[model samples]
Target: MQRTAAPRQIAESLTELWSPRIIGELDDSYVKVAKVHGTLGWHSHDNEDELFFILKGQLRLEMAAETVTLSEGEMFVVPKGVQHNPVAEAECLILLIERKTTLHTGNVVTEHTRSLAEQLRSV
Candidate 1:
């Protein structure tokens, strides 16, 4: 059977902070939704790029070079090997598109890092 979902609806349904739940799969990547607040810390995916799409609210992506602010209906792609930290002032809903092998947190792992197994669980 093929699973169908509403990314925005599911994104809003999430209650955990920084914990991303897999909503679907595409080719070699996974589509995930997360409800975030505060910062996720600095990390870099050495080999894969990550896409951040705001479903609701806003986000600020901080990197060594610069910071990018994204509002609702906006998106950004953090290229491979760039260290970034995502921060949300209030509760925000976001959709992430990343390679299946991408770590929850790139090189740096903190208390908020979610393992692949954890993300793969049913939403």
Candidate 2:
């Protein structure tokens, strides 16, 4: 198996504002690191659940029913078919877990969704 340093650092070292790097992948699942700021569009995945782990800074997940804020070392799970939007006031690093076939924004295709596929890379 291939091993490397923590996924958190991989995000922190990135110079881009909203780019992601694939740290690892196992069968149907993958681990990715991203640097986020501002607000992401509301979207949902029809076939996959998503897990977000905060490695540094803070993030907020807003759903139709409620909004959850995550600090460093915290995590939250977004079930499949539930629409949610992710936001960050300041730059934050996050680790995302989801199935390989999972689309970034499900059926709500946007410019953001266009970058999702390219962001995925073999570890």
Candidate 3:
């Protein structure tokens, strides 16, 4: 089947906060969308980098050394092994590009941590 996904729409339609839904795949990567607010725990991917694109609202990426803010249409890539925490003051829509093996919350398991099976389910 041939289909196209509207990332923003998919993200906006999400009913769960901090839960990411898989929308598409590219080679070894997965394209995902999530509706988020508040802050996600600090975590790091030991092997794969992660990309975050702001579809709506803003994101504050706090790192071990510095903090970066991204608004709508902005994107940033967090390098592998770099500890980061994503925070949003209000509800935000985000698109995530990451390797299929990348864990949603990296090595840390918290209340917000979601399993691959959970993330792969229909939104």
Highest TM-score, which number? 3
Candidate 3 or 2, higher TM-score: 3
Residue 111 in model 1: shift from native, Å?
0.9
Q: Please count the clashing residue pairs in each candidate, in the order shown.
A: 0, 0, 0
For each candidate, what is the lDDT? Answer: 0.93, 0.84, 0.95
After best superposition, candidate 3 residue 58: deviation in angstroms?
0.1
Q: Return the lDDT, model 2, position 106.
A: 76
Q: Candidate 1 or 2, higher lDDT?
A: 1
lDDT of 1 at 79: 99
Error of 3 at 20 (Å): 0.5
Better of 1 and 3 by TM-score: 3
Query: Residue 28 error for model 3, in Å?
Result: 0.3
Once fitted onto the true fold, the runs of candidate 1 whose alpha carbons sit more than 4 angstroms away are 1-3
Q: Mind sharing the TM-score for model 2?
A: 0.89
lDDT of 2 by residue, 70-89 (tens): 99999999999899999999
Residue range 69-119, candidate 1, lDDT tens digits:
999999999999999999999989999999998999986879999999989
Which residue pairs overlap in candidate 1's backbone? Answer: none
